[model samples]
Target chain A: MSIWEYANPKKFMQTSGLLLPWVTGLAAIALVVGLIWGFFFTPADYRQGATVKIIFLHVPAALMAINGWLMMLVASLIWLIRRHHVSALSAKAAAPIGMTMTLIALVTGAIWGQPMWGTWWAWDPRLTSFMILFLFYLGYIALWHAIEDPDTAADLTSVLCMVGSVFAILSRYAVLFWNQGLHQGASLSMDKTQHISNVFWFPLIVCMGGFVLLFVALLLLRTRTEIRARRLQALLLRERMA
Target chain B: MLPELGKYAATVLGAYALAILLIVGLVVLSLRQATRMRDRLRDVEERVKE
Candidate 1:
């Protein structure tokens, strides 16, 4: 019933199995609808033309890139405080996915930029900090794989996550920290300035939600796999000892 | 979609294609890795049972 109860492997596996199907189904639907709406239904920007459509994917992916790091930071904190094996494993599992999303966002952003800003690369605050965030993700992931001892890996990874969280927040707010160059205002906001019209916003929200769900499903799958792998290693050691 | 920008379209499409391909490849690799580990776990459990 409580979060701690699901810390047990058996309970976690069962719950993940039950939830995976629904998550997959919803993600598929949301992606399809979002792509269709973004590509066709949304009116092209008066200034940017059809290329602006890339914003639908790029924005959501960028948002997730920062948020993924935050989630890892939280998981790492929980693992360090409670020494929950699942928490550490989940943090490890999430690293690759977060890195992938960050790459997508960076590439898509550059592509979008060439047509609008006439330059593929910019030394602006937002861009520089985002690149740093990506580097931090790579470092975190590398640290996990390089460590042979699981306990040491978890401990070091927790410290790295905490350190990375500072950079992640700075990367997210980099635009506000310094006057930005080509990057426009937030596409979707709480105040509804409506940089993007309704037709696109609806589908973009769906895609963003779908992407978050996909991240969750992948993280769960990877964490479960890691747990099983560890269990197998333990058994092998026990057999050898006997 | 850009009529005069046909060359740029190729670049854009290429980037998107590569990203999607990478994602598909990563998914396949992860799924295979998960299943293989699961099978190994089962085997160890069964051996212990014996």
Candidate 2:
């Protein structure tokens, strides 16, 4: 069957309901194992010391924060093009989760930076762009609530999502574009020389996997709730009309 | 037993605490909303049938 068939609400619900338990279980396992490994078993950095452990949460949260927005951007695009309610609701469902990720990243980054950089905050390009991304998330969520009509809210937020995507891209690559930032270069990169050492790398990869799985599980759950809420609204409206 | 975190014990622990708190809060809120929506939808569906 074509992928679009799942765009239908019933099919989407059926598949997601079956998938949710498995995804949630895997996410929990990965997160528990990864965090315990990173926190208790990993060696401290010579320079950064135990503060290095914060990387487990910071990097993964930062990655998901950006990726969550990208997911919403794609969903928004689909809604704009295909006029699928599921796509629109999915975008709506993703915003708060993205915002929380962004908040986690920022807070953890600040805590890590306090010792490493001798400061808790900076206007460095990467940090600044991430802050902007957080604001975009807030604006996107606020726009949804402000509009009473679902379709109109979806339309406006889709446009907003498109506009905010530029900043998201900027946030993702600001380190590359600006070399002078206090923020360090990527921990995981294609260049082996630039990559973090294997000692810390393995558990980090696991943590990243956990974060991704967690995002998927949360997205499915939230999207199903949004769909149900929409259906309830429709049923109430029908009853009123009758 | 906790790993020896040196002078940054507070810092490391604080970050983990905050992050975990936020994540748990988000999960609880989402689950609560999902349950509420599910129950409301079921009730409406039942009333409509009646």
Candidate 3:
């Protein structure tokens, strides 16, 4: 009847199950096409040369790394205010995915940096903030594991998410605020091309789309598992009581 | 066909390789967890029914 109705485990499971194959198929196609096109088809930058090819993976992974945390923040808020079990589990389900994205971005950035910046690492504002954001993600996940009661864990993580969001925002805007970063200004922008050539741009966009779909497919799969695990725990507890 | 990457071939290829490994690893682990939890839950449900 409503969006929240799908939050019911049965509905969520059935709906996601039907959608999984489609999402997975689309993600595979896009990722394959985008990566192949970007890697083999596009011309090397006049300045950065072939090292620029790394942007396809680095930028999208970095974008998703931040967006994933933001998604968890929203989900955590919903759990705290609306008391939705799905929301809490969704937040939980997303953390590992987010963490992986962050790691991907970091690794890719460092690899790219070695060619461009002549260094594998830097303690600049953007890079440092991102590292802090990764630490926040680690702490949030650790807190979830440390608590036994689901509600308590959800509540604590929700508060932590809210708190971590402030630092995340700072991390995102650190380049703008500090202006002392080895990281360059944003490559993509809404108002203009931001120096990204069309040959490179389209494939990068496609890759980002693929990553988004991949994130959704993964979130759905993980959330459903968490729901099933919770259900099993409840059932076992019931059997014991009976 | 693979494009020539000049001197930066290792950097480009290594980044892609690491990304592939991480993404594939995550997907495999998540799917396995889902399958495992579902199977375990189903088994318990069947046992209780008996």
Worst 10 residues of 2 chain A by lDDT: A185-194
- Quantify all predictions' global Cα lDDT against the true fold: 0.80, 0.96, 0.90
Where does candidate 2 clash, by residue pair? none
Taken in order, the candidates have interface RMSDs of 3.2, 0.4, 0.7
Docking class of 1: acceptable
Name the top DockQ candidate. 2
TM-score of each: 0.93, 0.99, 0.97
Q: How much is A92 displaced in model 1, in angstroms?
A: 0.3
* Candidate 1 Cα deviation (angstroms), residue A49: 0.8
Across residues A1-242, which tens digit of lDDT does each residue of candidate 2 receive? 89999799999999999999999999999999999999999988999999999999999999999999999999999999999999999999999999999999999999999889999999999999999999999999999999999999999999999999998899999999899899998889988888999879999999999999999999999999999999999999999999
CAPRI quality level assigned to candidate 2 from its DockQ score: high
Q: Could you report the DockQ of all the candidates, in the order they appear? A: 0.41, 0.93, 0.89
Using DockQ as the measure, what is the rank order of every candidate, best first?
2, 3, 1
Indicate the residue-level lDDT of A177 in model 1: 57
Select the stronger candidate by lDDT from 2 and 3. 2
Candidate 3, residues A202-227, lDDT tens digits: the string is 99999999999999989999999999
